[model samples]
Target: MATSRTGLDEEFIGRLETSLDIYGIRQDPSLPPLQQTYMTVRAGQDGSAGSARLALPAFKGDKGDPGDGFLWQGDRTSAELAALREALGTDQRNWAYRNSDNNDLWVWIGSRFVISPDAFGAEGPEGPAPILVGGTVTVNGEALDQPLGTRVVGSDGVYSLGVDLPELPKGEPGDQGEPGSIFSSPDITGGPTDGQILVFDNESGKMVWRDGYLGPKVYNVPASAFGDWSSGLTGTRHIITAITIPAQPYRYRLDFDGSVEVSSILGQTVDVQVRADDPDTGAMVGVAYGNMEATGWVNQRFHAYSPDPFTPDTTGIRVGVVEPGVEQTLHVVAVKSAGLAAAWRVAGNGRSSLRVKLERMP
Candidate 1:
């Protein structure tokens, strides 16, 4: 009743013998005698010699010489590989690599770097052309004069084929808008008078026309107006001249330019002041001071005004504000400081005239 090697009996015997030996059945002998007998009978029926070995433990062989195969030095760039090659000259066994710039791998084959072909696979079949669902062509919103090709997302939220759009036509003319307000518009209240300018009125929130140029206004005081002050006039203040500033919406800057002949003892000083007062309330708005220090009959040019008039809450003179239709007055006054009993006088002549500059501020 021996079964040939060609049959399932032989195959079953071979597999069972391998499993028994792998489970250490031969060394341990833990199986019952009935099962052991059954295994022996099956092997005999399959015509396999009972003396044949199944899964014997492999014997350890002697260690061989170091391999002549390529040694993986580690990943390196092209420059690094070149340096390494120069340091550790070409041996057939050295290997180093860097990822290729393209989708391949660069390997150092000891002598020089070469691109490996293992990174690429066989060419795949061509894929079907992307189905274009739909798209839109727009103009007037932006200038796309040249034909543009772009991928568009369909309503289904998937990106389809790229759509090539031709140069779009110009959009139809839009409805005419209402005309905008000009200088003659009724929104601007006031004159079309000569030498008038358009200015915004914050109180009325409208544009207004006012007489005069928008630049600084200059006022020159005649030399005859600056009368001479005789000697022995110490501890006294004399009025030089008064300037009237017309009512306006903005604050004003007052600057002064003048010269005076000081007849005084050495080291004595004469001080001058420019003061602004509200004509209606008589309230002192601001004041600026200047001085001249000299000996007998010394003519000195003086620029008398606050260092910075536009700054508010400052220690010195500040910008002056005039109410609408109410004029402001600026007075130039000179004072001789008390000193030695020596008599002195500040004389004003043709060169002693004052020039006052008024600038409009926002």
Candidate 2:
């Protein structure tokens, strides 16, 4: 019985092989209905092969149930569509068709109608430039009208705005601020007194108040007081004019302008001196000198000045110390030169003048 079963199995295998030879495998057809069917073989958990049935349908299954459809709101104008959306409420399935003249298709999506393929219309012609009308400006509820013919022209518009604003009502005065320092500073010493001026003190590196002006003082010698002098003999000195300077620390400059007349052609020269004299002692404290050469008959114009600044000796005389209203006198004098066989004279009438300039040095 086993031998017979073996013979039957071999015979069945031979018949299966013969059938495959008779109908060989061909390429899959392009059409879905005529395509060859394949059964999927999956590996089981035990590593054994597992087969699944390949069910190929002779035709497609019956169609599915239809979904909710969009109710056509019809082709309407924008105003009409707005009215229809208001009437129909938020029915999202509702839709409307619109031609190019009326825009695109729109669907009502609960809140509003949204257009499909949202596109803009053709651009229209540009409108005329806007004209800005003139108006008044108000400040604090007070109106100020625009001035006549005052127009503000802008790039796109013209306006007439009032340039002047209405004056506001006066407000209450504010509290006064703290007093500021006029001359009271760290760099300045001593309080300001009446008629006293500020002067920088080098020793203390501060500004101090001085009794007199800090600037230069000028004194002009009176022309009427100048006297003419003539000396036939040499070594004769004559006073021309005098200038009085106030009691103060000063550097003096003496200037003399006069004409020298040489009566004798043999006269060589005449000496001119600016001498600072102590009024109390009649003693000359400082002297600066120059000379004029002889020019016969014709009066030779001469100008003389102090070679250096003259500082009065404040420590010498009682008048030198500034307290008792001390004063210093500067005298302009002319002397005939020694060893000259001539007569020389300085004419004081309208040809002689002297000026004294005093400056504060300390």
Q: How would you encode candidate 1's per-residue C-alpha lDDT over 1-362 as one tens digit per residue?
A: 44466644543233434223233333332432221211232353466644333444434366669855545555555566557656654664346454433334555565666666456455677665455443455575665546566675544334455667775776789999999867668789866654567878999999888764467777876777767775463446566667776776555555566665556676555555556763323433333222334566666554644333455443343434443456767776655555555566656656566677666544
Question: Could you tell me every candidate's TM-score relative to the true structure?
Answer: 0.36, 0.35
RMSD of 1: 21.8
Clashes of each: 0, 0
**Candidate 2 lDDT over residue span 54-136, tens digit each:** 44444435566975566665566667776666666654455555634556677776677767654436667766665544456
| Candidate 2: C-alpha RMSD after superposition | 23.7
| Displacement of the residue 130 alpha carbon in candidate 2, Å | 61
> Poorest 10 consecutive residues of model 1 by lDDT?
32-41
Candidate achieving the largest TM-score: 1
Candidate 2 residue-wise lDDT at 72: 66
Query: Residue 1 of candidate 2: its Cα lDDT?
Result: 23
